[model samples]
Target: EEVTEGEEVERKEHLKTQWARLEAVVGTKARITLIARDLVKHFENRLAALDGKAMVVCMSRRICVELYHEIAKLRPAWAAEADGEGRMKIVMTGSATDPLDWQPHIRNKLRREALAQRFRDPGNPFQIAIVRDMWLTGFDAPSLHTLYVDKPMRGHGLMQAIARVNRVFKD
Candidate 1:
């Protein structure tokens, strides 16, 4: 569908006019820094209420790294600088050959499975997981009660993402 300037204008005006008649849904367009801030706040609140973990889905690895740093700043205990033992949060993305200083947590398939297991474990404090395209589907975590989506997802992909938290747990 080639949308001309005039047609685009008309479409926008029509949508604007019908805005009140239709339910409005605001999508994500915020800066990564700001989104990270809100994500932490949501996690803190959910922890208090449900005592569960949270997952953050980003559009790209770059944004995932950016959000990880931002959230790390707010929650020092989750940052790599906090301790040598481990961090509370982990970034799970596809492995890269040329390693970057910011993405120490990027893992291979086997290691990714390990991290996914840790995230699923209730005993572990690995609370928040930041991902680009990994773990949105076929990964089960019953303790994960919160998901902050910073990317657009639809259809089966969206359903699978929601299924991550829609598991039955004894807790």
Candidate 2:
């Protein structure tokens, strides 16, 4: 069932309208932004007490970027230069054509692996990672004490994500 260009545009506009209505019924962007700011502050205190890192899982790449920027505004220390050293970073899969892809943190296998390694190192500056769907499995970070999940998950996916914070780190 191939649709005409006009039909596709109509469908997209319909979806956008529906999405806007849904957002109004559930939560507004301003409310979410305020909560994200508070969540960063809350987690900062908790993570500091535990002497551990954290991972924040978002539902979409767009939300990941949005939350990162919001939190960065509150905690300027968490904002890292795309090419320089920083403790906080966003990890999401993106292709070369994706305009939102950060040059230093583009989501390739090699870059993902490198970021994971840094996240796992307690002495390293990379303390927090914001992710959408990456590092849900086979990635280990014993020092990761908390996982803030803004996205929904169930069954195996849910279990694997929970396991991320269950590892024991020798202090």
Candidate 3:
């Protein structure tokens, strides 16, 4: 049955209110720091044993970068000044016009391709990748066993994101 315009407006207003509440809680620095610590603990206790890699799907590019830094603070070895040398890296595309702080995490096409190659290698030190949207589809790494989703996703996009960890790896 077709709904009235009033219902559509009500639904939109409800969704906006929900999103605002979610952002208020999740976007806080304290919450992000707690999440970062939990992620590190989870990695150490579980994924590290299997020699597995993980992906962190964040709400946005800004959150992706913030979470990367928070995680890095807990594990300095995971952070690298150079794009090509980090164990934990953010894979997002951005232009020079974007915020200066975000520039380091942003990469050109070739650099992203290189990061993709490094991530595909099971033996490589590159283990955890933080991303907003780039690798949610058309990317595969068999050794990846965990997906830490801090973002809200649904339907096809959600399916594709979770499927990143579903590829068959060795026994």
Candidate 4:
């Protein structure tokens, strides 16, 4: 059957408009966990993709120290371990140290490694930290919900963190 030219144009225009509307509403980061100052606009949109659930966080060491102090003393449990239930673990991935004071960079790496080992069973830990490292894009874990970033990231690095929580799970 011969197709009408006007009908084709009209259909194409309708589809284009619909696509634009859908994108405007969802954006890029919708339905994933977020790590930022506010949870209003970007974070909330991402949360929609998640359908609102719990997630684990792999945090950096320096930031973890501060977070640790607050969570332990301020509102929730004091110990890093969750009491009588599954607790989030911190896998602060880092390297070794030389002379303990020979190089500032070396010292920093040591700190990160120390933090990663803190959790012991990082594969299953709910909370973890990674200073000077990235794990969200490639690493897969069921409970990894939140990504508390305290480092500078842009371009592909940003995309990885957003992908971390979009993974569909049965739990």
Best by TM-score: 3
TM-score of each: 0.73, 0.77, 0.86, 0.40
RMSD to truth, every model: 8.2, 6.0, 4.3, 15.4
lDDT of 3: 0.85
Q: Write the per-residue lDDT of candidate 2 for residues 1-171, one digit (tens) a residue.
A: 111223677787786666556545434468658867778787879966778888888766666776777777777887876523676888877777666434445656776777888888888878878887788787888888888887657677889999999877876
- Worst 10-residue lDDT window for candidate 2 reads 1-10
Residue 157 of model 1, lDDT score: 77
- Candidate 4 stretches with Cα past 4 Å from truth are 1-60, 75-78, 81-86, 94-134
Residue-level error in angstroms, candidate 2, position 9: 21
TM-score of 3: 0.86
Best by lDDT: 3
- Candidate 1 per-residue lDDT over residues 23-118, each given as its tens digit: 122222256667877777877887777777888887656567767777777887677533223445455655466458545766557766777777
What are the per-residue Cα lDDT tens digits for candidate 4 across 69-160? Answer: 33434324323442222333233434564333212223244543443343333343224333334344565544445555544445676677
lDDT of every predicted structure (CA atoms): 0.67, 0.74, 0.85, 0.40
lDDT minimum window of 10 residues, candidate 4: 28-37
* Model 1: lDDT of residue 22: 29
Give a tens-digit lDDT track for model 3, residues 28-101: 89989999999999998886468889999887677888888899899999999686687999999898998888
Residue ranges of candidate 1 with Cα displaced over 4 Å: 1-30, 81-90, 94-99
Where's the lowest-lDDT run of ten residues in candidate 3? 1-10
The runs of at least 3 residues in candidate 3 whose Cα sits more than 4 Å from the true structure, single-residue gaps closed, are 1-21
